[model samples]
Target chain A: MAAAREFGVPLTLVGDRERVEAELARHDCTGLDIELWHASEVVGMHDSASDAVRKKKDSSIRVAFELVKGGEAAAVVSAGNSGATMAAGMFVLKRMRGIDRPAIAQLLPTLTGSTLVLDVGGNVDCKPDHLVQFAVMGEVYARFVMGLQSPRVGILSNGEEASKGNELTRETSVLLREKPLNYIGYVEGRDVFNGSVDVVVCDGFVGNVVLKLSEGLAETVGKMLKAEIKSSLLSQIGYLLCRKAFNNFRKTVDYAEYGGAPLLGINGVGMICHGGSNPKAIKNAIRFAYDYALKGVNSRMAEKLDESFPKSVREREANEAPADAKERVVS
Target chain B: MAAAREFGVPLTLVGDRERVEAELARHDCTGLDIELWHASEVVGMHDSASDAVRKKKDSSIRVAFELVKGGEAAAVVSAGNSGATMAAGMFVLKRMRGIDRPAIAQLLPTLTGSTLVLDVGGNVDCKPDHLVQFAVMGEVYARFVMGLQSPRVGILSNGEEASKGNELTRETSVLLREKPLNYIGYVEGRDVFNGSVDVVVCDGFVGNVVLKLSEGLAETVGKMLKAEIKSSLLSQIGYLLCRKAFNNFRKTVDYAEYGGAPLLGINGVGMICHGGSNPKAIKNAIRFAYDYALKGVNSRMAEKLDESFPKSVREREANEAPADAKERVVS
Candidate 1:
């Protein structure tokens, strides 16, 4: 909310008016110049997003996505059911032209800032072609959204060797290695935190697992340590003395430190914030959506896709010809 | 170390004779009745386990694994390079009969006690057969080590739907569902904390990522909350007054609360404790190792592998057979 205030974007609350008003009051933002986009109901919980989209037609989540689709809103930010978010974003906002699927690109916290892991619970069965597309989309998104001029892309695999990983990753790695992006062969899970690669691509199944596990680990370890520190009077005093340093360290690993995940390769800007996200995270996601809008990420993705797959099949076929035949085709 | 003393395990100083003697005196263990197992020299920091095995010959780590291998020690315990430990265990002790790959199983702290995530960075490119082996080993280890009977086994996937996960997990899920074990079809990352399943199986690649991320998330959330608590004087005072309750909460989520990961499917009792493990963690790991050794995990794994394979194969083949061939195989 502070980031939104700083950027001077109107804040929209898409939930129950009374509850959201109470929440805004709690945060002292009730009368502090924030707008509410009231929706009568919330989406179904534990139900597939298809059901939500079909049933909850006037739901806040669906309405938010509609606003973005209709260009009424620059972006749609939600901390609702992740599956529902992805479904709504894909169904309502739609995929970018030439892009096979929309991928949830998550920024993971590493010792050296954040690395983006895409398809973080978007598509489970990612084909080789889809991964090639992911590499391109992730690269473009990282450059535009994350401001990395030339983002390094890697296929998350079982090992660093290109031959490693399951069938999907292996096939994807082969295709990625031939892509025009700054492709960095196969990277292991450890590489996600090593700051070696700017973007890591994997099927949504593994990506979701990695994201959740990372979040769970950080929470589990921090809680355990705090318990140990407060167990004794002396340690409690010591914790008090080191409180500032501890908070600093905590901020370094916090999930909200980076904004919400952007649903890359989508036609319009869409971000899925953590369901338990505070106002700060929602604001960050909105800011990200605005920045993405300004940068024309969708157009860039379309251009890249067009270049990869030209309008004329003859030209595409000639370009895709063998290396030796490439000279003849050019001549 | 205090826990070990309390548990009545004879403490042994395994280092340079003079330094060991000096340290023993400094720690007041000189009069506490402990033994000294002196090595010729210290294991070089970056040295391989084989180097320590060959050169120092009596280094603590090497000696401990030797004790387990030679039946001189009930179990080996170490908080060293996990790769090196697995390497040493493989080379020195070898795999148990019928076990393809030895897996490192780590416990993930959930809201409800804890859940076991097996193959947490042991063998990366695990095959379907290897996964079946993991399930058997995990079940035996959980039953004996964790005291959970009829542990629910779920293959970690993108969704709870059986159709989810990669080809590997899908095939493994099919194999698991037909097996006699309490097989749940597929589980999501959140299910790790939901107590829906006792044992969650995945290849080491996913397992390693999940394990580290869980640890990182736990630490991150713990620190964030601690920071929140310390942000205000009133909150700080409240935290101090309720420090005991917080400590109990911390202990609930502590990774060390579950001790260490047992390198299951190995011939001998071997445990891989975290490298950054403190003394309390070391003590707990030792206790887990002792329990594993007593339970004859290796023999049980071997037995389970031998009995489960043909049954699993027959069942899979029967289920997979054409409608006409079904009766022939059954008959």
Candidate 2:
């Protein structure tokens, strides 16, 4: 709220106005205006949640998405069910040309800086060509969002050495190594932190696991350190003396530091904020979405789609892809 | 050095004897006992690390292993190349009976508590029986280490539905579910943090990917939080006022909280500490190894092996197992 108010952006509370007002108040954000978009009780916000956009004419999430889609709002921000938001984004705005599936891309913090991990949970089972597409999209996002000139693309595999990992990762690495992008060879899980690859691509199943595991570890480590420090008065005093250094260390590991993740390959700027997100994260997600829109991420993705995968690969997939494979994708 | 002196655990310093002694004096660890196992030359600790273990019989790592093997020391601790440590362990101490591949299992922090993640990076391509063995080993380790009775084993898959995941996870899930242990059907990556499953199992390739990704995310989130806390004076004050709480948060996310991960299924108590471990982590790793020895991990693993897998399955593997596979595995 402070960031939005600092930038002089008009902020409106779309859903449960009282709750939004109370939350803003807790953050001391009264300067940002609030409005209640109270729809008819009979045709309330829930109707707009479905991809069938016609169902709910006044659903809060649907109305907010509509504001972004119709240009009334620069960007839409929501902390609701991600599936509903993704559905509304696609059903109302649709996918970009030449893009087969949408991917959820996140700016993962690394030892060097931050790396982009794509398809975190959007697509569970990914074809080799779809992985290639994700690599291209991830590269572009890194170049724009993270300001990398030529991002290194890597397929997250079990091993860095040749002939390591399962069949899918091995095959994907082969395809990525053949691509024209600054594609590196196979990268292990450690490479994600070592800054060997700017864009790490994996199927959503693996990607989701990686994201959650990292979060869990971070929280665990943080708690353990405090317990250690609290065990003695001298340690507690030592913590206070080096508070600045510890604070510096803390800043490097926070999730809200990177803002929210962008839902890539979609037609419009769609962002998914953390469910327990505060005002600061919400403000950052909006800023990220605006920047993505300003960079024309969708059109650039369309232009780069062909360069990502060869025509031969596409033809092979078309011929060999099972008729029900797409439907078989869990999410 | 400060914590060790306070805790009364005599610490040993390796590498250059004179230089280490000088550094210890510099850090006021002069009272602490220090020893040096000088090699013929400086080991890169990365490239020739494995060779150092294989050829250099008097190297620091080798000496440390011997100390443990000969019962001169309770545990061996080294923050060197994990592959080298694992190699030295397998070659020196060997694997347990009926256990083909030795699994490196680590405890991951979760909301409910810490859950055991097996095969962090031990074996990439694993057979279904290998996973079953991991289940038995994990079940026993959890009972001894985490102290959970009848730990629920959930094979990591793309979905919770039994029929989901790749061929390996699916087959493993079936075998695990049918076992007498508390097999909890199938679980996804989310379940690792969801606190629903006590033991999350996967092939080494997938497990390593998950582990690295988790570490990377924690580091990222931890850093981001620190940065945000310092972005403004208000946040700094908020952070300062909650200094105890913040440090508590920091400890929770730190990797050293749970100490080292034991390379289970090995003949001896071989624990692999993280490469970036500090003195405190080394202490904990030593403590964990002591507990492991006291519990007789190998005996328990050996006891469970013959009964863990069905008679028909073991007979099938024995008949169909490749010659080289047999030598590498069930020796």
Q: Which candidate leads the pack in DockQ? A: 2
Question: Judged by TM-score, which candidate is best?
Answer: 1
- Put down candidate 2 lDDT per residue, B1-331, tens digits, no spaces: 5434544444444455666557666666556544454433333445544675667666566655555555455445557667667776666665665677788898887655878988886487689889888888898888777888778887887666554576677677767766768888777776786578888888887888878777655655556556655666655664555567556655655668777888776556667888778877777776666566666655665666656755644564332111111100000
For candidate 2, what is the DockQ-based docking class? incorrect
**Alpha-carbon shift of residue A28 in model 1 (angstroms):** 21
Global lDDT of each candidate:
0.68, 0.66
Q: DockQ of each model against the real complex?
A: 0.18, 0.22
Off by over 4 Å in 1: A1-101, A107-116, A125-136, A146-201, A214-261, A267-291, A302-331, B1-4, B10-66, B226-231, B310-331
For the predicted complex of model 1, DockQ is 0.18
TM-score of each: 0.68, 0.67
| Stretches of model 2 off by over 4 angstroms after superposition | A1-4, A8-74, A194-196, A241-251, A310-331, B1-102, B107-115, B125-130, B144-148, B152-175, B184-198, B213-299, B302-308, B313-331
- RMSD in Å for all candidates: 10.7, 9.1
* lDDT (10s digit) by residue, model 1, range A239-294: 67557656776777767766688777666676788878876776677677666666
